[model samples]
Target: MKIEVNITKEPTKEPISFEIVDMSKKKYSEVKIYIPKKKGRKSVAPGDKWYVYFYWRDPETGKMNIKCKYYRGINQKKTVAEREEVAKAYQRSYQMLLEQGWNPLKNKIKNQRSSPKKQKHTLKSAIEYALAIKIRNTKESTARDYKFRSQFFLDWADVNFKSGLPLEQFKLEDFYQFMDYLELDYINKASGERLSNTSIDNTRRVISALFTELKNKRLIDTNFVKGIPKLKSEPLKNRPFTHSQLIEIKKYLEEHDPYLIQFISFLLYPILRPIEITRLKVRDLNTEDWILGVETKTEAFSYRKIITKMQPIIGQMELKGYPGSYSLFTNENKPSIWLPKQEKSKVNHFTNRFKKVKKALGYGKEYGLYSFRHTAIGDLYNSKQAEGIPEQQIIYDLMPITRHKSEAGLRNYLRNIKIALPADHSDIYTIDF
Candidate 1:
């Protein structure tokens, strides 16, 4: 038995048209039956009828056995086009199968419908995904910190977990043990010292955030990181640079390194963190507005200080790097290592340089890199008072410059910094009214 399906198309000048012809040699005309209309579907194309007929040979009788035979028109359906396509495909296969002397229907048929692929809910993939999300949302230095912590989580899971199974199986006990391991057992490989309570707390915090993100995604039953408390640590003592010390440092840097002058000057006028200073790009400076922008760490602007005269300094800086092209600090190929490879590397590359320069000029280590900012703020506060400006107004003026998030923190900056105001004689002339 053999069957052939011939397809012809209309000419390009004519409307879309297809003609299918069943040029089949074998026909089970006796067993052929009409395929019925599918219920609740649109009627098939006008006057189009369908028929099916199948047969296989039996070994014992040496006779052909009929499997199924159908012939009919189906009602119109949204998929009438798809139905027509399947029919054409069946017709195309008929002659090919006959030539091969095999019938698929005579044996076990292959299922054409496929099942959907599943997503992995395993712990390792989820942590990596969450870490990626973390890195995207934060700055480069912050991303590095997250990556370091993520390694700890992975190493612990590899050793302690059962092939590091899915998050759904992660329990509260697992969270507790991991946190305890960081606090009590873990040691810094480079420093050869135990982690501080504060560091342990921060590690716990990042891990907790990891679980929280997974929980929100419905990947876990709960965050599994609760009841952990932050460590209570003492704030380090920070002091300001004095007027004479500032004069000395400037005079030395002007003769020694001209680039250091502009860089250090930006830190003083803007009163920004060292990291924030290093992250500044050429585009962040606006000479027209006399404002320098702090884009990441803070959203405030630093108006060029009147006493230091920052606008001229910024103009000179623009000439060094193409505007909107590179960092304010360097036009070199790569960014400066503001976030040094390790925290201690900062001691040699950053603090020691400042420390060495200052100490050579007869200043102690007490006048640190941040002292420049503290000194500027202290001077601004004192200068305003010396100019007879009110206390509340001075605080209001410097709050944004210092980028203190709250009033209490601002008060802490003002404490222990003495500013002598001239005796107020205006009150003596006022009546008791």
Candidate 2:
């Protein structure tokens, strides 16, 4: 296809219009024009002029097409050299498009109508997407934690979580501001302490993940936190009951609240989490084997594990006035009672009751509800070690009962157990070993 160029001037026109025709001897005589928008009632305006380029290719053979770019100028006059330069630039672009077998006249019109639209990406939008992805894969408790912490991010940054901003738009300054907001402004309602570094770090990690998703989708150019450092946390202090303290609590529960006796046995004897114990039904117990079937938080299927100390307690419960069908612990008489199902609230109540027992026995504030779990695990670790069991083997045995997901998780649990153990044998060591 041959190229054609034209220059023309006409007077007495309302708004000047320029047209270019592909004068090649072809089947269809394709044409393109430049018509500028009029400005207010003015006959001519400098901004009213523009260059409109076009191309036309044969539809049958799928070959090269004739192309043209008409340099349309309105009130602003152009010199011969300027017009020639504009024509030459258009010719170059036309030739490039022709080489790619693009019909400028047809493609340019289509492109003008169907050009790719830009979406408004915000920080809020990214968070929503990230949260949706998390909800699909994570447990309810995990999803709740993410949702709870996400509010801090939204309130601090003053961004909506649903309308995610582009990742590229985030600056280092924004991160520093967020951290400052968490440290200075964000306060825990329960403890009134400034948000902990660990908590803040978790929020940061979520934000980082959001940006990662955006980058993966090619929605953003870069992750803003590429060089940012994670917040550090101090080692947690060990807090667990001494063997004598455990015995004292058990005796108090046996005398005062028979229901609590079974609960304590579930904790110290079988090494069951309070939630796992509460979730247990009468049918979950194996009287013959003295095993308690516990449904773990992570898994759907229950696990049956023996609790030697619990055998006597279970027999005692059977001997007591409680019915066989009743829960080991209940607020009301017999089979069923609707108590608070929230684990944290139940734990808090247990802790308060434990405090009363501790005060009665003259034990200090150091003993808490969690002490029972710590003491049980510590006792097991010591007993296994004394029996010539390797640390790894002990960990492996405890992993299923503890419901730890990874070897690292089990190792951390063991580390805590060791920390909770007494320095002197006579101070807090269990007699079971």
Candidate 3:
């Protein structure tokens, strides 16, 4: 391989010129350019000659080799000092490469042995490249999630990734290490709680999706997480309020803080998830039919839930002058406005207030905001039993209203409701019909 330099002066800059040329065709796959730093020297004139060197890989043994190449301006002549400076710069570069253990002659011999190709993958470079490819095709939210997980992976894992690391190098042990980190990391933004099994499971799902993409790209031969087990989570449970408990909560809120009444009603009757109920708009309500159209976060089409019992409350909200804007729940003091928009905090505040209200009403610490939703489902289940409806029918009705993904999820919700119900009621196992 031969080293060559072609110099071109910038139109407005002094002393700094760019040297452009293909070095060893076998050493580097792409063209290389060397930009000289202006070390307080006057700019080169047109037709000046500058000396440069290029490095190439030997075809036989894949070692680096160097040769000299020179550049001359088409219309100007160069002073002896300018030529000397260029040669000195080349010498410095060559010395630096030699210090790094690159043997120019050995590379030339190595290049002769086989066709020149890009170097093999390092772990870091492969991961970076793979993530970049994923970012381009995925949603902004998905990309953000990948970026978050990748940051943690980079911090904990040792991989030589510049552009990206190869997926094939990732192991199941790495996945387990990541899970352990997540589980042991005690800091949580929400509630300042330790990392729970649920949170770790969510992280695992995202990572699994990321590796799945790498597999699809043929970057990895197998899913590195294939055999990794997830941390065990507790069974699904719902905390529901009893009938007397509900009345007491209503009385307390009505006397002390009326602002939360509408929000509570939205939760209690129609059984809307807090997120869905908060985002509801006035236009989503069908006044005559008592149906509230709920736009879920995961689904595209709007699903309707009947809140016929709350028609008067909905009418009162309209009379208060909150028209078809974004949020349905609003503070009574400012009827025209939705709940204060510090999302996560606002939800937390609501839950905390519910706990306080439950305590005041003598319901103990077990009742919570979610207790309302569970209570509604429990009510429906008991009503069905009273009306001679079978367990399957109760489950079927609860499915759409609860928006549970599977029958088992609905059943679990029901089981939790049963556990929370009053123990002394003799009709616990009896069907009235």
- Model 1: worst 10 consecutive residues (lDDT sum): 109-118
Q: After superposition, how far is residue 86 of candidate 3 from its true place, in Å?
A: 46
Question: Residues 1-433, candidate 2, lDDT per residue (tens digit)?
Answer: 6756565666866555665555454432333334444553312245545454555445555444544555433113232223333333344433433444454455663362243123334665456544544543443345556666665677655652322445456677777777777768877789888866777788888777766766665656677765578777653432676767667777887787656666766777667776667666676777877666666666665666665656776776563443445554545523354345333454565566767887888876555656677777777777777776777788788777666788898777767455423233475656766
What is the lDDT, from 0 to 100, of the residue 24 in candidate 3? 43
Alpha carbon lDDT at 69, candidate 1:
41
TM-score of each: 0.54, 0.57, 0.58
- What's the lDDT for candidate 2? 0.58
RMSD of each: 21.1, 20.9, 17.0
Compared to the true structure, candidate 1 yields what TM-score? 0.54
**What value does the lDDT take at residue 405 in candidate 2?**
84
**Where does model 3 exceed 4 Å of error?**
1-155, 158-165, 183-194, 235-238, 331-349, 352-367, 415-433
What is the total number of backbone clashes in candidate 3?
Answer: 43
lDDT of 1: 0.58
Better of 2 and 3 by lDDT: 2
Q: Residues 174-255, candidate 1, lDDT per residue (tens digit)?
A: 7778877877888878988887676777788887887777665556656767457777643333467667777888888778
Tens digits of per-residue lDDT for model 3 on 111-140?
Answer: 421321232334554444455445543333
